[model samples]
Target: MGLGACSTQGPFEEKDRGPDRPVDTSHVPDAVPRHEVRTAAGNKNPYTVLGQTYHLMDDETGYREQGIASWYGKKFHGRRTSNGEVYDMYAMTAAHKTLPIPSYVRVTNLDNRRQVVVRVNDRGPFHGGRIIDLSYAAAQRLGFANHGTARVEVEIIVPGDQPPAPLRAEEASDAVAIPSGEQTYLQVGAFSTLGAAEQQRERVSGMVGYPVVIHSPEELPELHRVRIGPLTNTTEVAEVREQLRRNAIEQTHIVKE
Candidate 1:
């Protein structure tokens, strides 16, 4: 589906009976990490669609989120996606609003606990309340093809990151704590105006429940940095980064103090 104009209606209304036939999904494997050279074409720093502008993420490390997911089927088949690749409904690919094109993400269906890793190569679902848009085959594998939408979790799979082991019943409810000495901070944005910095600090503090501080460096008195920390570790930093991204805060710098 084109990110610029994603329509709910399919061009072939009659033949688009969904992926009703059983097809071999053995070849449809999860997206693996490789040394990818990013180009400037589809990796638009700031792109406008339907009048609203979106800023793409510079890195996909540690990005995770939970939201409603929708899918595109035969309607967009054979069409070129935002990344210039021809859209294949049967491929394990997806469209994300702000994720870097060609990134890999692990999508989990919350309702059924089914998971599938998909390569994000396009931008969209622009419709309200949807986070990621999956291909028809992906949706079928996740068991949401018949339902049209599902509550899902999308987590970025960085290179060298191992797949998480299944959690036991007791372990699922426990929180993972970072070591005391390993704390870090992520400075999400900075502003020359203290009010702007305070406003952002307050907004993000409410979202993550962590102390969002306005730090003014002695060397750079004019700059007020809006920072969130002391994050337990890199994992926490990644989780907070994803939360901030959902709130439209994209620019961030990890700081070790």
Candidate 2:
């Protein structure tokens, strides 16, 4: 066997990232647990990765562990996984070295206590003693995609077992509807003078088609606020923010009023 370093993933795969303004994945549900036949495709035992041999688990009965979790995105998206299935970074899936291929596990982010069920269809996370590797969407839902790594609890989920609702008892419900006429804005810059604000306005105006405005608060007459807004939603704000970020404009905050 001419197996090179880490068959499906390369050393630099951690550099993977999602879209500039990540798509709204809140609507994307977690992988529903289901029974699957164990196949020999990715279950070859005693596999070697970078000279270290790892054996696959014969079964996942009562398997549970805690360790660091990282996510993979565009770098491995659309690629063939260890089990001969296509890797989708947006899907609820994960890779584990020892777990049986096609197993289901409920991963709870220890940092945020956010939990999500994912299908383990691949093998890896061969670097950094990480116990598991999650897809980008799974990491996003766990609230640690940006931080790069998070402490997590991974427990095998039996098929047909109702996946736990991810809500926390103390967590305030987000069912509150946005007040009608509420608008979102991006506050890009602020200055002490109108001239500076207008100059920055002209600069940011050419950056995008979004409306640019300058307002001076009555309480702080000396303060000139330069903002781009009443944008439709967070997605548009994210796009504008990314565009500004690319132009070396890192100082931006959302404004909802």
Candidate 3:
């Protein structure tokens, strides 16, 4: 997909950060100084931000409740987020202020009871009253893309526990269902500088409609490409690819890892 298409199709534009545009935090917060820590002698990779103590997820980690949910797309297509991944606002991913990255959650639009399963990949909904942010695809699945936001009940779905199947696309509001096929994921972007990648992560945190995450190269320890999706199969890749193209991110290449 080309950036032009992604930009024109979505509600927000990266350059058009609204009149009341909030302060941008792409640069590291003043509190987090730049530093590097060493690992065992043979290890060349230094520990980045992953070790910072985060709030613990505990028994309190089951189903969650009421709050406003919002959808984001286009404006942040290629921007780095706080979590170190480039944002793709069109996948079945999301952002939650406290949910652990990569955890699964079931989001229900309480007004319509329309629901969708999403992965918690990034941190956010920093705006008051907003509990979650879904990708464009997830919003459409829940029947809210045209309306933009909705009151919702976000339930934390334990990985092995599948909440009742989310209302099918036709049953919801004519939104398209992710086609059934082989499971796959796609790499969207990657950077040698963790800070740069994180900038893209934060940019998407506010605009995505599903669980969007930023994984550390350290954790996956490979080629280090930023990725989006728990895409059920390869067929869905084209739709996702289109969204990326529309966002002006035409160079985004597909990678199984």
Candidate 4:
């Protein structure tokens, strides 16, 4: 998702921009994480782009990194991506240099703590310092479309490993199913600034009556996470989740510690 068009394994490369009358993608649903069979269309082990050679990973297992992210927009809209899928700037898709084609990645904007799961269907971002290229809609959901670029953490998501969610929307990767023999928390949200996290903390505390707290992990000190409960059992987790549902909170995520 290099802006406009910096590099591609195939097709035209040109300058990019938003649509003349851009459609609002603020509420675009995330691409659901699924077990997609990798294809050879864009997963070339050794590929050359802009005089540099890159090797695509056989799979995205255990892939995680933090770096700058750019985006692509209207300029390449409707054009075929490196993987043969038509580029839709408004879709929850992305381009990556090495990740396997069709890998689902969770990208968290380090500046605002906004996150989105994007399907990697193309190759690119030949630019320096950028780790991933996101679709316009993906960038918008991550709260960085207007800024053009953002520092972000990209983590590979294994769909088959995630517990099935009975309380959350089927299309959302936010919440997960109950677990056994493990401690967990309900993460209502995350923010970059302390003020924002505190505001959410106040609201969530009043809603669930659980021990709501904000934690900034050492690995990502800038992240202010708003979590509720260290529910020891599935019964407690279900009780808290029922209360959350009563409070109309549906975007809850499971944080297994």
Please give me the total number of clashing residue pairs in predicted model 1: 0
Write model 4 residue lDDT over 29-134, tens digit each, in one string: 5776876677878877798767788877765688999998988887787778887777877668899888888888999999899999898998878777789889
Q: Write the per-residue lDDT of candidate 3 for residues 1-257, one digit (tens) a residue.
A: 11112222223222322213221112110111111232222121222222332352544356587887776665555555444556655446676655555556778888788777765555555445677777655776777766767888988765434443353333344334444663345555554345666766665444433344555644433213456666654445555655654554433444344
lDDT string for model 1 (220-247, tens) is: 5545777888877555666776687677
Cα lDDT computed for each candidate against the true fold: 0.73, 0.74, 0.51, 0.75
Clash count (model 4, backbone only): 1
TM-score for each of the candidates: 0.58, 0.59, 0.44, 0.61
* Candidate 1 Cα errors over 4 Å, as ranges: 4-27, 163-257
Clashing residue pairs, candidate 2?
A: none
| lDDT of prediction 1 | 0.73
Clashing pairs in 1: none
- Model 4 alpha-carbon miss at residue 218, Å: 48
C-alpha lDDT of residue 203 in model 1: 83
| Cα TM-score of candidate 1 | 0.58
Cα lDDT of model 4 overall? Answer: 0.75
